[model samples]
Target chain A: MKKLFFYTTLALFFSACNKEEKQNYSNIAIYGHGGAGFESHTNRLPANSFKSIQKAIEVLNADGVEVDLQIDSNGTTWLFHDQFLEGKTSGNDCFGERSTSYIKTCNYNLGGKIFQLQELMDYFSSLSPKPKVSLQVELLDRCIDHSLLIEQLIAIMEVNNAYDWVQIESDSPGLLIQLKAASKHFQTFIRAPDLTSCINLCSENGFDGIIMNNTDVSVKDVERVQALGFKIALFGVASQAEIKSALKKHPNQIQCDNIELLHRIMKQ
Target chain B: MINKGTAFILSLFLFISCPTFGQDSLSSNIKITTHFGYEISNVGCYGNIGGQINYKKFGFGLAYILDYSDANGLDGPFGVATTLSFSPNHSDNKVINHFINLDYRITFHQRFCTFDCSQKYNKIQELNIGYGLSIKIFKRLSISNTINIGWYLEKSLSDRTGKTISESGSNSLINAKLNYLIAK
Candidate 1:
């Protein structure tokens, strides 16, 4: 009877080990840009509102997705593209004035205001696939209080336990370096518009990789970056042709407005 | 050169509207496919061996074929072709695959003299859509029964004909393919 019990326990232990192994590996990560920006003109994506964004995230979970974020000058992080809430919101033309109070008072045309950084993080944590998907926060504010913004953002993400699945990024070299130093845990990257600058940034700082417009980059450029043992993050590409072009570059991650298109191009 | 407006519109349609045949996912793997089949034409019947390597949906490959006809005896052509297939994933074998293919073949033909003093021969420039069945023979190979709806544009030089003769037809071909899976 004791031998039987021991054998049963051993079988159960191996079964538990198999379960852990199953969760450790997954190949696909589908990236979705916030609400289908310019990719929608041809993609004809659904409405670009909060509900659509949430739904898009859910659809992305079925295949894995990466969300975008940016911080404002007032030390508040929000889900937005531009640095200012001017023409996008009330057309006030107030650039660099990203205060939540000012943004709240104005009437946004879409009937929904910007999502607070905490609120966005909370939404992801509440999802079924909480940390499987990741985040790429683009530091949009040029004049942000880097230390304060990084502290508060880290506090929020830490509280929600999202640092495990998020990476902080920016277009400014100095800002990205500062943010990385402050966080210490999350990976950091620089978003450059040109390939030469991207290569220089990645090599100079020993960054994880660089994200750039797909059309602006060439295969040789991407190959050079990859040859350096650094990763390549591509963005703003939404078609099969563009994906095929980007693949020649051998990107580490490709962020697109159309996740379906990414899957198609990659599958081939 | 085509007008900018027309080119722009056509490019826009090709860019945004083209749907891939498979599921979209992020996995870095290369697919290698090889095919062998027979071809029949007015000149003769030919056996061909072709292979292709597709990396992230773009294909580069070569084909070598031998032809034997009642009129022409035996002739061979070495051809090279590329495929641009847009799709999400091929996990689910599809019956109709939408793809654009460019094929060039260098073969021997009787050069005819056109009435306009132009040259003509039996050369085909084919742009085709693959519509058919993909059957998995085992784990390593797939046999495809496909019909290609293509535009066959021929350039000829003869006293009675012009420089170019075009025809649209459905060509039936069977492809026996060997597939290697490199990624998920």
Candidate 2:
């Protein structure tokens, strides 16, 4: 018995660092990150707003949308992408960085103030589809009371009743693990850069999936991670050639910066 | 108690068997190496700087690499790696030499933080084994290249999930280094 166990361990160490097999790739997901916000381009709606969110869903026909999430000191959750308001907003500083009162009244360059997650939920409720979306929340390493942060995020999602379609993503492994601990069904993912790391992390932890940047991942990488049963989200798309290359790879999800362009390309 | 004893004995045996364990303590060399590596499985490139300390056939080294921004919005990724190598019947010499290696790497990347004013970075750790060939040139310099393959265990990921992640097919793990003999 000891010999058998020893040989098994040896075999795994030598041969099982990674594995791959052929699988069909017809069905995949397409998501518009930050509502594919390009005000100068086709969609006139501002990014991360109700207007663009709807446009991304109805006009662009994206399967889902990736939204930036920030929680203020008062525990209010805002849905914007940047760390600061510079270049994105007409405001002087960060929306969540300042007082909640300031965030509520603050003006933005894209045409609106920092909106709450409840408003996003209400808007989705008004729609027929409720727009499948993922919340890419930033994990502030060294932040205090991680348990409290998880509680607050869960409470917000619960009150908004967004538990069904909303998923959560972060670059921090610790944050993602805590989230899964809070709720097994609250789907979580890591913004994975290394294929080996992502697979090793997600399968060992409870992460439902991983998001890989297009530059760091290949078509074959998508297949391999997916084979391990972790959903693969190909993110940070810019040019037409990159998206074209993404299509050939057939990842489980594609987070597009140019929503309308991606929609058009996918349709063709 | 039995498990602990067994583990201690095993470790002691391994340590005593190290290549430099019985060699003269005065015969040690130090080298600094700069490397550029590319991982073709996912199509990424990196630049690295490494420092090595050796006593006869056994050597240890540390390396660091930082990734800049790319068109795909992947940037600010950095890694620090440590390596342990032992020459297989081939220590310092004019002929070709072979070395076996055990490597550990920890990588970090930037992420925006919510609910606070501070910035945060996430980390990933990996372990790999390597094989290399090296030769001396110019009497004071050496050029070496290595190929490595091994499994990685991402922190919190494997500890929490209790499962391992695997990659498919062969991953390109090639690196070339130019070592400048710093001390002897």
Candidate 3:
């Protein structure tokens, strides 16, 4: 009995140490969330910065990046995530309330220059193999004319020849409708609140895809969405477990916070 | 200002020089040990200081663990652990001592946000049961390795938006400890 117990414990130990079987993830596209992700502690650079975006594409070799875009007073699109610049940057007031010149002067508290969306597109245009980019348009300030903002953004993409590689995502259905109506070539996605809403919104609005939080949907829900002939993208993945869970669902894309961790797991 | 490494070294030296009390027998002697180890878990590596009282093959210990990771700056998930251990074979002459332990730990997870400059804290309680193998390297020093499967009883977090999210999951931890016996 003692010998049996010892062997059983040893067998358990070995089983625990063994690695799990690796699954093929070639079909899944991995995109960085706000560039290389937005962890306050782990991230070396500020989120949505040019440097962060560059690192995610160049260093991490991600399939693409999902960046937050907010238009300034002069209708120039800038990369930012916050509604108000008070906490994230040295400047006060809403990001949309500031002008191009005033916004340029405002630096991120984490030490980086505020860059324009045109600059990013210009850079992408210069690359030999342009990386895929997803612009998450934030319609926070109701004062800014949405039509003008959309026009400016569309123009920038057209001028830079970025339409082929760029995809647009937004929570506002009105903005998405306007964008889709403006150009059918543009791949527009709706950021849904939940799985049920995600499927309903995508089917109803005829969006190219639906983006939902990884935790909000199950594997069956992801399959259900895909079975309806709509692409599904999952985000809000930070840890290894979250990444694995998201990958198991086999979504079309994943906007991960820890791109390096996801890459490591993919390699395994 | 002593860093954690320096403080551990200082404590090691102090423990090494401390006088032994009572008999040197395994059953009668109480052992105070300081363990420095790396943990392979989401919570990251940890440094532990603990004391144990043994009676024959059975032992009980209380340890304070400080978990830290350099990959994500100074994110800390410190914990307090209580372990009940049983040695299958306990002999001073044996070079290898194998034991099984059941540990209950309460860890405080903390994350500091740069956006709002806010500190988010949460409590996670888990039970880990596993086996360990310790090799006696010196007269009063041993090197040990343990692998545990932990089941979280309760784990909840408040994200950057201050939304409370509860998750249920299980994780495994592998730890290697350089244990120094202060009293035996």
Candidate maximizing lDDT:
3
lDDT of 1 by residue, B1-184 (tens): 4322233233323322232224255234555555665554322244555555566645555655444322122222223334344433444355433334444344433332213444323454445455444566656566654444443333333223232433223232333344333223
Instruction: Tell me chain A's TM-score in each of the predictions.
Output: 0.71, 0.82, 0.90
Better of 1 and 2 by TM-score: 2
Better of 1 and 3 by DockQ: 3
Candidates 1 onward: DockQ, in order: 0.01, 0.01, 0.04
RMSD of each: 25.4, 20.9, 14.9
Clashing pairs for model 3 are none
Candidate 1 ranges beyond 4 A from true positions: A1-28, A35-49, A60-74, A91-98, A105-107, A131-147, A194-197, A265-268, B1-184
CAPRI quality band, candidate 3: incorrect
- TM-score ranking from best to worst? 3, 2, 1
Which predicted model would earn the best TM-score? Answer: 3
- DockQ of candidate 3 is 0.04
Interface RMSD for every prediction, one decimal? Answer: 31.1, 18.4, 16.0
lDDT tens digits, residue span B1-184, model 3:
4333333344444434443444365444455665556565433456666656666688787666666443321124567778898997888689898999997877775432223234344566767888999899998788988889876643433222344444334656676778776666
Question: Which digits, one per residue and each the tens of the lDDT, describe model 2 over residues A22-59?
Answer: 34433877788787454542233467876566545644
Which ranges of candidate 2 are over 4 A from the true structure?
Answer: A1-26, A38-44, A141-148, B1-184
The window of 10 residues in a row where model 2 chain A has the poorest summed lDDT is: A17-26
